[model samples]
Target: MAELANCPRCHALFVKGPAIVCNDCVKREEEDFQLVYSFVRKKENRTAAILDIVRETGVEEYKIREFVKSKRLHPAQFPALSYGCERCGAEIREGRLCESCTVSIRSGVQKQGELDDLEARNKKEGLGPVTYYTVNDDNR
Candidate 1:
């Protein structure tokens, strides 16, 4: 079932289906993709970076990045094509984050798990919050 919604790109009302944007925007994007694909398919432009492709093809950087993210443009064939990490703005060929950010997040999760285990052990052992008292010389 298609629902009426405004297109994200052109703000035109259209039936929403598998695509997020309206038909007009989709057509425009297809044209842009063709322009970019033609430029990158060239032997001399095979090694061109995203900026170079944008400059030569007159295509938006985000559009090219979107193609790379969607796997329409493969980085294996064009080594210079890549997208930024979701967490950090580091250039990455695949996945949401770069290797460094993934490792850091994994390490943090492991450390949190260890802390939770230790807390559970302390609770099971009947250990509550620690209390400290200072002696009063007058009372002593």
Candidate 2:
């Protein structure tokens, strides 16, 4: 069943199903996509960067980035097309984050897992009472 909701772009009420925006916003988005697609498909504009395309076509940078992120624009054909990392503002052609951010996040998770394992081991070993030991200086 479709739920009634307000369109994100124009704040108009519409049935929300597969699309978040209303029909009008969808049509506008389609037009923008066509404009961007047509511009990028031209032989002379094939090598143009996202900024160049935006400047030439008067399209918003975020719109172009969205196209690239959604796979609407082929990164191989448009080598300069890239999006900012979600964690860091680094240029990346694929995925939500750059390689460095990915590694950092993975390392952090590994460290957390190791800490949890250590805590589990300590608990399993019975963390009950504390004991202290003393050595007599005369023994030396």
Candidate 3:
């Protein structure tokens, strides 16, 4: 069998590895990566998320994702600096959704609130005091 080669994007493959393209593809990919990395590293945009980076730079998410992984890159030195879910504040690392959020979403078929359903159930069953919920309106 033919020896594997690195993909221009990932630089990895099985016995017949990836990156079958010649030097030109590699060079182009590298240039694109530099462009993206440079943009992401900018002081004004270092904290941008994957979508923000793509939208701001006009690069496709697909290419941006590839560059992020292939380059082993981060939006910023501090993980907290990286933009993430507005709702959960999860550290996305690369993609828009964090691993935890993704798992949480996948675990349930129907999209629903994290705690809304439980609270609704407790109210329905009249398990008021035992139910987990806020007890103070003005007592705070």
Best-performing candidate as measured by lDDT: 1
9-106 per-residue lDDT for model 1 (tens digits): 88999999999999999999999999999999999999999999999989999999999999999999999999999998899999899999999999
**Collision pairs in model 1:** none
lDDT of 3 by residue, 79-101 (tens): 42344454486645566677878
lDDT of each: 0.94, 0.89, 0.62
**Which number leads on TM-score?**
1
Models 1 onward score TM values of 0.89, 0.87, 0.41
Per residue, candidate 2 scores C-alpha lDDT tens digits across 112-136 of 9998887788788987444689999
Task: Give the C-alpha miss distance for residue 7 in model 3, angstroms.
Answer: 8.5
Model 2 bad stretches (over 4 Å): 128-140
